[model samples]
Target chain A: MNSKSKIIPWHSRFDLQGITFLFFLLLCLGSFPALEGSGRDLDYWNNLKGFALKLFPPDFSILRSTLQGIWETIQIASLSTLLASVFSLFLSLGAARTISPLWVVSITRMLLNIIRTIPSLLWAILAVVLVGSNPLAGIIALTFYSTGYLAKFFSEAFESADLKAQHALRGLGADQFQAFQYGLWPNLRPIIWSHCLWMFEYNVRSASIIGYVGAGGIGLHLKLYAESADSWNKFSLVLLCMLIIVTVLDLTGERVRKSIRDRLEGKSSLIKKGD
Target chain B: MRVKNLGICVEGKWLIRNLNFTVRQGEFLAVRGSSGSGKTTLLRVLSGSITPDEGTIEKENLNSNECAMIFQDLQLADGATAITNALSGCLGRNSFLSSFLGFTAQEKKQAIKLLNLLGLSDKLNQWTSTLSRGERQRLAIVRSLFSRPRILLADEPTSSLDEKWAKVSLELIKKDVEGRNGSVICSLHDSHQARDFSNRELFIDSNSPENWSIQDVESKKS
Candidate 1:
C-alpha cells in the first residue's frame, strides 16, 4: 500500500522541548529579584568578615548552662517523637486506603493534611502563647507537627504493602485485627521502625529552633546572645553546640537506619533465594 | 452442605447466577470451568469470603472457622518460615491472644507432622519464598490440612504441579477429607483429573442460562 502520511519533525513528536522552555522561563522570572539583591558593595563583605572575627575564642563561662539547655532540647525532641509515633500509629490505620473504609481514609487524610499545612514554628508559637515559655510547650508543638508528618508517611507505607496475605487470613475467618497482626504487621515492622527514627531525627532539629519562641532550649539562649550584639562569642559557642548535637544525632540516626536496612535486606535475600 | 440459587455479581456484572449444589460429608466435588468462568468465585462464596448477591448456603455442623481454602496463588507469607505459614491455618480456631503469642507445643507438633507427611520435612524451617512451585503447592495443602477443616475449598490446587505431584497432592487432600469425615470442593481445568479424583463433578459456564450443571462421575467410574 502507498503511504499518504507526511513525516513530523522530532521536536513536534513530544512536548519535552516546550516543557523545558517553560521551565527555564519560570526559573529566570523567579530568580530576577534574588539576582538583583545579590549585587552588594565591598563594605558589606568587610562587615561580615568583622563579625566572623568576633565569633572565635567563644565564652566558656556559660558552658554548664549551655549543656543544660542542650539536655532540655534533647528531652523535648525525644519525648515528643515518642508520643507522636504512638499517635501516628493509631491514625495510620484509619488513613491507609488499603485497610480503612473510603470515608475514614479520606477524613483522616484531610485532617492530617490540615495539621501538616501549619509549620512547626507556627505550632511552637501557638503553644508558647497557650502554655507559657516552658519545655512542655516545645514538646507539645513538636509532637503535633510530627504526628501529622509521621501519619502521612506511615499510611503510605501501609498502603503499599501487599494485601494477598491479609485476604488469605480473612478467608480463614481471622478478624480484621488478627489478619493485620499476622499478615500486614510482619511486612510493615521494619518500615515503621525506620520512619519513627527519621521522625525523631527531624524533631531534634525542630526542637532546637522551637526554643527561639521561649520554649526552653539552647535556641532561647542563642536568641538572647544574638539580640545583645556584645555576646557574639557566646552565640558562637551555642551555635557550635547546636552543630555538634545535630551531627551526633545524624550519625546515630544513620547507624540505626543502616542496621534496619541491612536486616530487611537479609530477610529479603532469604526470600529471593526461593524465587 | 447445600447451596441454593446462589449468585455472585462482581463490579455490577453477574459472574455466577442461580447456582445450586450439595456436597455430602466425605465427598469430593470437582468444579470444572474455563478461565474467567467464575470457578474461583464459586469456591470463595462457599468459603464465606464473599457474600452471594442471591440465595444462601446451608452448611450443617460447619462454622465459617471450620472452612479452609487453598488459594491458587499460594498466599503464603513470604517473610515467614514454612512452619509459620502452616501455623497460620490454626489462627482461625485459636483464641486471638494465644495465636498472637504463637503456636502451642501441641499445635507445633501437629504442624511438623503434617509438613513431614507432605514430603516437606526437610524444608520445615525454610522461608516459603524459597520453595519450588510444586513445593509451595504441597505446602499450601499441608497448611489447609493443619486446620482440620470440615469444608475445604481449593482453587486450582494442582495447577502448578507435575502429574505425579498433582496426584499425590490430591490423594493427601482426599485422605484428609476422609479422616475428618469432611467435604472438599476444588476447581480444576483437567477433566481427566476431575473424573478420576472426585466422586462428583459440577460444570459452570458463563454463557449458559442455567449457570451450572452436575454429573455423577463416580458412578461412571464404577
Candidate 2:
C-alpha cells in the first residue's frame, strides 16, 4: 500500500498491445504500393456501374427465370438446414459436457472440427462425385457445413445453461439423458432456434455459390451465363436474383428470430408474474 | 445411516478430520459451529456430496433415492416456478424421457398440494427468482421433501431470512420431517435459533486435525 513499496507505477508500464497494434499498422502501410493516380480506383467503380446499368431499367422479362432460380436455391438451403439441424442435435448432445462424458465429447469435438475445417465448396465437389452433379450435392454439402457450425454452438449453449438446475435434477436421481431433456434442452430451445435461423440465411447464400462447382442450382446457371459473350444480361439477371434471394432470407430470418425471442421473453415474464 | 471417521482436506491442509456421526429415522441433529468451523463440510459429507478419505459409510435402511439436500444458496432453478421446481425433486423417480415431456397431471397436483402446505399456493407458477429470499429457501425445503427422502440435510437454510420467516421455516421443516417420520440434520450459524428449533444439537470444535469434539449442546432455551 506504501508508495515506496510500489515496484511499477501503473502509468509507467508500456502496454504491449498498443505497441503491437502500431507495428501492425506500420506493416500494412509499408506493404501498400502507392497508386500512380488515385481517383477512386476505377476498376471497382467500373464493375459497379456496368453491373448497375445492365441490371437496372429492371428486366421484368427475365423475372420468371430469376424467381425460379431463387426458389430452387431456397429449397436447397431449407432442406439442407433441416437435415443439418437433426444431425447437429445428436452430435451436439454427444459433444456437450452435460450429456456426454470427457472422452465422448472430445472425440465428437475432434470429428466436428475436422468436418468444419473442410470448406463447404470442397464438400459440394466431393458430393458431386458421389451423388452426381445435382441439387442433392449442394444440399449435402450445406448440411455438413451447418452441422459443424451449429453443433459447436449447441454444445456451448448446453454448458452455459444453469448448471445448478442440472445438478439438482441429477441429484434427484434423473439419468443423464433425462437431465438433458428436463434441465438443459428447455433452456437451449430459443438459442438453438436463433442459430438455426442464422444458418438457414447462410445456407441460402452458400447454395447459390455451390452451383459454380457444378453441384446444381442458380450458381451453375449464373456460371453458364457469365461465361457466354452475349449473355452478360443473363449474368446480370442471375446476380440480381441472388441478391433478392439473400435479402428476402435475411429479412425473414430476422423476423423469425425476433418472434422467437419475444415469445421466450413473454414466457419468462409470465413466469415472473406468477411470482 | 452412518458416516464414520470422515475427513476433508483442501490442498494438503486438512479442514476437518475423523468426524463420526450417525443419523437415524425421525431424529433431528443441529450442527452448531463458529463461522470458520466445518459444519457445512460435515453436512456435505452427510448428504453424500463428499467422501471421506479414511472411513466407510453405511446406509442400512434408506436407499440412495432416500437422501436429499437443501443447499445454503437454495439452488432452486430461478427460471422455473415453485410447482415446477418442486416437481423437479421427484425427477429422480421418473424416467428422463417422461420428465422431459413434462410431469403428469397427478404429479403436478401433488406438487401443488405440497406448495400449498408450505403456504406457497399463491406462487405455485411464479418463477423462483422472483421469490423473496425466505420464500426461495422455503421452496427449496419443500423441494427436498418432494424427493421423498428419508433423511434431509439443510445447510444454513434460514441465513438470508428475517426472524419471523426463519422461525416459520424451521417450524415447517420440523413439522414436515416429523410427518414423514424422516430424520433431519441441519447446520445453523445462529446458536439461539438452533437451540430453539432442533431437538438435539451437535457442537463442532475444529481446533486441530483429528481433534474435533462433538459436545452435546443443549437445544432447550436456557
Candidate 3:
C-alpha cells in the first residue's frame, strides 16, 4: 500500500450520488405536506400585497422614537457581544485541550454544549423571567448565546493551531502564559477578532427579535405595531431602520477585516510589533 | 549533562537503545545519523520536551528550564515580527507583567544585535511570515542565543542555509557557547561540519539501535 494510490470500488451498480440527490428531493416533497393544512397559501400573496400597500410613505411621525428603539437595539447587541467575547475567551482557555487537564476540558465543553443546546429565543425568555424584561435581559440572553458559540469556536481554533512554536517556547523555559502570549496568540489573533466581529453582527440582527420575549429591543415595537392596525406603516419604518443598520454593520465588518489583513501581511501600521 | 542506558521506544520499535554519553562543559558535541536516526528525538530529550522510555539524565549547575533549542522547522511565530521572535527567548527570565509594557530597552538592544549578527538587521520589524526560509532559520538561531542558556540543543540548525552561511553560523554558535562554558548538542547530516566544529561525535544507527556509540572526531578520522 503506497498510500497515495486512490481506492475505488471494484464493481458497484449503486449510483450513490444519484440516489443521495433523489433521497433529498423526495424528502423535500414529503415535508411539503406539513404545510397543507394552512389553507391560506393561495391568498398569502394577495394578503402580502394588500399589507404592502399600507407600508408606503412610512410614518415619519414616529421616526424619532423608532431611531431611539434602534439605538437601544444596537446598544444591546454591542454590549452582549463584547461581554460574550471576553467570557468565551476565558472559557476556551480551560476548554482547549492543550491548556487544561482532561477533566477541566470535559467540564467546560459540556457546559458550553449545554448552553448551545438551548435556543436563543428560549434564553431570551429565561432572561426576561429572571431579570424582569428589561434591555438587560436581552444583554444577558445574547451574552449566554454568543458565549456558547464563541467558546466552541475559539477552543477548536486553539486546538488546530500548530503546536511547534508553542513546544519551542516551552522548551525555551517559558511558562504556559508566556507560551500562549508569544507563541499562540500571534497566530490566533486574527481568528479571534474575526469571530468576535461575526458575533457582533449576528447579535445586531438578533437583538431586534429578542424583544418579542420582552427582553427589550425593537421587537417590542414590532409587536406593538403589529397589534395596532393603524400603525402598520410604522412597522415598515422599523424594518427599514433595522435593514439599514444591518447593512452598515456588514460594511463596517468588511473594513475591519481589511485592516486586520493589512496588519497580518505586514504592509503598515505601527500598532506595536509582535502580532 | 550525562545519560545512562538511554532508550526511547516508539510504537514498540526501539528508536534508540543502550545509549550512554556525557556532554561536558564547553564541549561541542555533534550528533550524526541517517534520516530518522533519532537525532531530533535525542535532542528533544535533551531539551526535556520528550521523556525517554528508559534513562537517567544527570544535570549540574543548571535549572531544568535553562535549555534553549533552535528547531529544524524554525518554529517562528507567523504573525509576529522577527525582533519579537528573538525576544520571546527571554520569556523565562522576565516577569509576566513586562509583556504588557513591552520588552525593555536592554532586551531590545540585545535582540537587535543577535538579529544583526545573523544578517537579519533589516528584518527586525518584518513579519515572520514574510521572511525567507534562510532568514527564518537565522531568526530561530538568534532566538536560541538570546537566552544565553547553559545548554543549547539545535536540530539541523543549518539545513536551510547556503554552505558558507551554514559554516559561518555554526562557527558563531560554537565560539559563543564555548566562551560561556556552555555545552552544545547539535544534530547534523553534514559529516564535514561535524568533523570541523565538534570535539566529539555521537552516531546512531537507524537500522540497528544496538550499534549506537560515541567517539572523538579525531579518533574516527585517524
Decide which is better by TM-score, 2 or 3.
3
Q: TM-scores, in order shown?
A: 0.77, 0.79, 0.85
> Candidate 3's error at B157, in angstroms?
0.6
Q: lDDT tens string, model 2, A1-275?
A: 89788677775554898778879999989877764457564697888887767654544576687778778888899999999999998898899997789999999999999999999899999999999988899898999999999999888887777777667667767777766555555556767989999998899889999999988778887888778766777677777777776888789889878765654454333443432
In order, what DockQ does each candidate have?
Answer: 0.25, 0.29, 0.38
Q: Arrange candidates by lDDT, highest first: which order?
A: 3, 1, 2
Position A25, candidate 2: lDDT: 96
After superposing all C-alphas onto the true structure, candidate 3 shows an RMSD in angstroms of 4.4
> In candidate 2, residue B152 scores what lDDT?
81
Stretches of candidate 2 off by over 4 Å are A1-23, A34-47, A61-68, A93-107, A158-162, A214-275, B3-7, B11-21, B54-56, B76-82, B117-136, B162-168, B208-219
Residue B167 in model 1: shift from native, Å? 5.2
List the pairs of residues colliding in candidate 1. A274-B130
lDDT of 3 by residue, B41-133 (tens): 888887777899998778887875678889888887877888999999888888778875679888999899888888888888877877778
Candidate 3 clashing pairs? none
Q: Please give, for residues A1-275, the per-residue lDDT of candidate 3 as tens digits.
A: 77657666654434898678879999999899797876655787788899899988788888899999989898999999999999999999889998789999999999999999998899999999999988999999999999999999999988888778877888888887788789988888887898899999999889999999899989899999999988889999999999999999999998888877776665544344443
What's the residue-level lDDT of A181 in candidate 3?
87
Candidate 1, position A35, lDDT: 61
